[model samples]
Target chain A: MADRAAVPQAPELTARRRSGLPRAASPAVVLAMLAIATLAAVVLFMTLDLRGNLGYVLPRRAVKVAAMLLVAVAVGLSTLMFQTVTANRILTPSIMGFDSLYLFIQTALVFAVGGSTLATAPVVGKFAAEVLLMVLFSGLLYRWLFTGGARSLHLMLLVGIVLGTLFRGGSSLLQRLMDPSEYIILQDLFFASFNQVDPALLWASAAVVGAIAAAAWRLRHTLDVLALGRDTAVNLGVDHRRVVSWVLLMCSVLVAVSTALVGPVTFFGLLVVSLGYQLCREYSHRWLLPIVGLLGAVALIGGQLVLEQVFGFDTALSIIIEFAGGILFLFLLLKGSLK
Target chain B: MIRLSGVCKSYGTARVVDQVSAEIPSEGVTSIIGPNGAGKSTLLSLISRLQPMDAGSVAVGGLDVAATGSRELARTMAILRQENHLTMRLKVRDLVAFGRFPHSGGRPTAEDRGHIEYALEQLDLLTLADRFVDELSGGQRQRAFIAMVLAQDTGYLLLDEPLNNLDMKHSVEMMRLLRRLADELGKTVVVVIHDINFASCYSDTILAMRGGRLLHQGTPGQIMQPEVLREVYDIDIRIEEIDGNRIGVYFA
Candidate 1:
């Protein structure tokens, strides 16, 4: 201790200089760039080769763009928050069987009621019921897993995978036993598509996603602390269990909304979040959240434009996005950067 | 000051920390030393409120740890575990800045910056503040973590095995730093240490445990004898007086 006192002190300015190492672009700049690109994609998608009845074509395109934006925000925010709470970069809500559970709920409803009644059911009532069920299920899962003794990541992954398989198996079994016509309707519901979003359902989902995003925004700083892992977050005075429960609840709602709107885009969130981390290179959620949203928007709308204009609507946007995202997932796994 | 009364913890059928009651006075270096699985770390965790006790009460500065809000307890005490595995990339300065979260709520004020700089200087990490934590060696990483806890600016500092992975020289430096913190800042520094010699040399009070119970608690001179140490560790350790500090020779 005495020897420490004898060590000569360097000037404070030099200490500051030492911290000024070269770094990636500032988070604000990256966010601006992403926002501009997203805007460009939206504009190009809306206006490319505008023709025919102005009111008809414009309203159709506007609805498609709105659906894309809502799903982008929902998926991007949910995936980022899920990864933060779980403290694993490779895991997403979809990978943990969230969408499968959603599909299970939808399939069970259709099986219980004939396809005609299910299709005739009030859209608002069905949407609310689905979102509530997803939220409740996730809340229960988080409470059981996180509140007790320490839980290993492997155990979590295994449980998620098992539950996902169970749900998928149950859905397929029900589908196999259903009427052939009903089975066709259920099959259409399973694949992700943006072509047939009901305008009323779109508005309700937007409202839900908007309210949740506002709540999540207030928790940005807490999210950053959460990314540090549970023990450290607890040491830093965070109510680890309560905050995690709330975040997980929000994630479930977001996933439900997005899956209800565009069906299950398994790898889309992974791609958006991975690209956000690579571009921003910062751990703070204040910037990462927006960057992820913009990136998701860009990928969705831009890919839609390419598919419509170049491929002449020959391929679905979700399939292409999932294909790219799945490859990135494999790349990340092979590179051993899960940490 | 930390007071424990009837503190107990167990995993399934095995009681890791039996009904252990003791008082650690404020503002000194107190080292809890014992053999492996002797419940030293468990006791520390109970006091820090890191783990819920099966049965017991811990009061720091007269505030009941269990009854108090986590944020209030955080303002009064800070604990560091042995292994800290971070999942994200963070610079040394950024990691240390997180210590201020209890006070700043993720937004650093000018006073917080002052605290951070003071902590960085005390840990001799000013030059390495820009480096990523993953880029650091084991000793450097340990120092960075200590610096983060130091920046928390709490009156009580609790560390479990602070010298677990350090070399001889780094371990000595860490012990000295703890000593200086206790002496200069008047902080109540409680450390669960494995090295009996370091405990005997640096700690003002030494608490010895064996078999999930605290066997002895006293000054270095009172607790450094061969019989007391043998009882605590189940090994014979000869105590030598070196420059008025009690040194233990345990090597056969």
Candidate 2:
């Protein structure tokens, strides 16, 4: 009974599928949606009237918008490539300790320089130092793991979790031992609040994000095959080690830009990428990457808009996002998407 | 043709493939038969460039697998390993179309589409083309992966335990298809097979291994004897000719 209706109507269904155009239609549509959402964010931030005149508000809002977009793309693209490399959707770069390393470096700076120096340090200098530390640590860790063999994946993940815990413990210890005033200064940098983004670091982060996006676009085809798992990708003539190295490097740079711009935002990458996967069911990266990038832009801008207008600035938007993302993470874990 | 010279692979203290050297024929299906833990799969992995060799070199169609560009090697050989895990949901047609990735680089032209359709039809998956691979039955999924290898349109194909989850009907169909691929298309297929009987019926050459060592390599008539199989498998086998095909019965 099922075959009879399905068989004869298969051609029509394929035709309908063509008209649907999943991969072709989604990126362009999501891009437009992102443009609208971003425009809304720009308008909302400009008119909110928290402090400052029109000239002050315009420049400040531009910096914040640029920071948000950079973080969105960086985190989004990093998580997407990370998931592809591991062949596991539930795990993110944050889970693998990149953010923790960031926290560690920040804490170490305060601990080493005796808190007062850190408080007086320029935001641009601090951000640059943090980015450099993360890039070096991640490159060393990922390069060693990827070049070695396959069994090291689980081992690397375990090591990353332990390292993250150690970093967190170390940071907390330093935080407790530091002077109270210095601790307050450090606290400002630790919390992931988009409202207090540093304007001085904007151009640097933009350049980084731009360079990384161009590099990722060049490796798009290799990334599509990489989704099939390392072995299959290698069999298909992709230089597995080289492509993976490039992708991991891109991920590190993106993570650095995002974390440097607006502190570390956990779970945002997961939320946007998952939505992107749902929107573009096809596995081709040519469509998937743009769709994910655009969806991330939309989520950030839209969430910001809702926070300003609907919440009346009463709550931190990251808290709300984390709550929902936390629930989705649990659902995905229990449902065993990785398995 | 695929050639392995003194290939050795080790994990910790244990050697998986130890000094194994062989030149695989340029045509016909060749089956590597060995018990679990024997270096059959590891050898296949090394030749396919999925695993780096610890000591030696593998060459495919005169290009050293180590030195050759992966894209160049990809146009020549395709491999399917067991336990394919997909984090993303991919339709059968889309999965098959990936075979053309090495050649077309993700943008499938009309020629690539034809290859994809032919592969799907070859595996009796034309009806299931649009179905998700993860949603298919084990046998169906196995066939889909094999079809992906065929769609690659390479001179050589390497498969690791391809019959792992396949049913009796599908397993026989798969062997027959591989045989046809070799016979009609002149594709050189090196498969790690579990069933000796299937190997005997379908393969032009058989390579037997034990404890990471190549124990024997020969044609079906030479390798299908009870004494040879008993020595290789450590199990008594009764070989009988049925309809001009050598069938090994091992239950007794």
Interface CA RMSD, all predictions: 0.9, 1.0
Put down candidate 2 lDDT per residue, A1-339, tens digits, no spaces.
Answer: 987878988899888998765445655575666567667766776666567576777777777677777788788889998888766777778877778778878888877887777667786787778788878888887776765556544566687678779878988998888888878877877767778877777877888888888878887887888888888888888887888877877787788778766677778788888877877756767777777777777677678778878888788778887888888878876786646
lDDT of 1 by residue, A238-279 (tens): 888789889889998999999999899999999999888887
Q: Candidate 2 falls in which docking quality class?
A: medium
lDDT of 2 at B155: 95
The CA lDDT at A113 in model 1 is 83
Check candidate 2 and list the clashing pairs: A237-B70
Instruction: Give Cα distance to truth, residue A325, candidate 2, Å.
Output: 1.1
- Chain B TM for prediction 1: 0.98
Alpha-carbon TM-score of each model against the true structure? 0.94, 0.91
Superposition error at B111 for model 2 (Å): 2.0
B1-252, model 2: which lDDT tens digit per residue? 788889899988999998888989988999999888998888888898888889989998898998888899899999999878676888999989999998999889999999999999999999999999989988889888888988999999999999989888888888998899899889999999999989999999999998898888999999999888888889888989999989998776
Candidate 2, residue A303: the lDDT equals 81
How big a share of the true inter-chain contacts is recovered in candidate 1?
0.61
Chain A, model 2: TM: 0.85
- Each candidate's lDDT (Cα)? 0.89, 0.83
